[model samples]
Target: MSSARPDIVVAIDGPSGSGKSSTSRGVASRLGLRYLDTGAQFRAVTHWMLSHDVDLADPDAIAARAAEPQLQSGTDPLQPTITVDGEDVSVAIRGEAVTAAVSPVSAVPEVRARLLDLQRRIIGDGGIVVEGRDIGSVVAPDADVKVYLTADAAARAARRAAEEGGSDLAATQASLASRDQIDSGRATAPLVLADGAVHLDSTYLSLDEVIDKIVSLVP
Candidate 1:
């Protein structure tokens, strides 16, 4: 613990592969605050739907069962966990299958509504770092520090491929691009930089550099 004030809340929003998870975890760990990966929450739900063989193509089908799964997100930055129906799915939710379905599942209004309430409940009283597409825009609009972290498409793709052990660079880039389009165009809380947020582009910045810059932004 750095002895910093614990009531501060940091909101980080960005497209996929922009290092939101890593950066948010680093900030929370450094400041001794809780960490919430809202993106992982969405992935957990999508994974459950896929596991249950839900008709993901039909919004009505997804909406009808959106509240069926019991989603729990552990807020520890060092060991953040997500479980669906008491099953620890921290690793399973990161699969390519869930990745492919997450956009559509997340775009469904009912799913977003359910998660938004959960996210807000987890963020109560601040002292946490929340990262997601809509964290700064909708989840924690009045966070003490709001950062819209991003990078060039090439950099983003390369980082994502590296994280996945190995992936087709061009394909990864294309997927990221497609996700950006869907996440940004959704009628619900689309991906966007919230007002008064500091835009930090990490195309050339090291992870520590990015963390340091964001940590400096704390009041």
Candidate 2:
């Protein structure tokens, strides 16, 4: 399904701390396109789950109430926002508790389906840089430009640790590895490079370099 609008849709997929969030935002802002953080959408749901005392392992319960929460995501490239049921969950979703529980919440087929639909709706308006683990592969397969970003585990962990306020490198590495396993092994919408996507390893590349490469690829 192609958009009727003239805006270009850029799909970016990558693991955590690979600069997907920052790069997408920067690229979109510079190019005048909207930005979407699909990961934050998942975190919003996970935050709701924890708030409501829902069992993270119960797929049926998650699926049944998947549409219960009111999720609204701002696509402004300068300052994106994600709210759940009128609460600003931008910061709360990134906490240790939400981070530890997001995987299980996101792994559910029901949760993925619900969020995927929301993502598509947002993109359908056109002109968005959607970043997530499976956006290029599953969320917007026909995206105008698809980019798969990656970096060394150590680098990724270091970036994540810094953002989380001096996290243990060892623990950060283990957490990233575990998240990779869960994200890539999940039965529904596993993380995989989309066909024709431009692969980029950000381990040695500056954020500007990555953004420049993507901007160059825009059609």
TM-score for all models, in order of appearance = 0.98, 0.96
lDDT of 2 at 161: 95
Deviation from native of the Cα of residue 109 in model 2, angstroms: 0.9
Please write out the lDDT profile of model 2 over residues 163-186, one tens digit for every residue.
Answer: 999999999999999999999999
- Candidate 2 versus the native: TM-score? 0.96
- Which residue pairs collide, candidate 1? none
- Tens digits of lDDT, candidate 1, 91-149: 99999899999999999999999999999999998899999999888988888899999
Q: How accurate is candidate 1 locally (lDDT)?
A: 0.94
User: Number of the top candidate by TM-score?
Assistant: 1
Candidate lDDT scores, in order, read 0.94, 0.90
Off by over 4 Å in 1: none
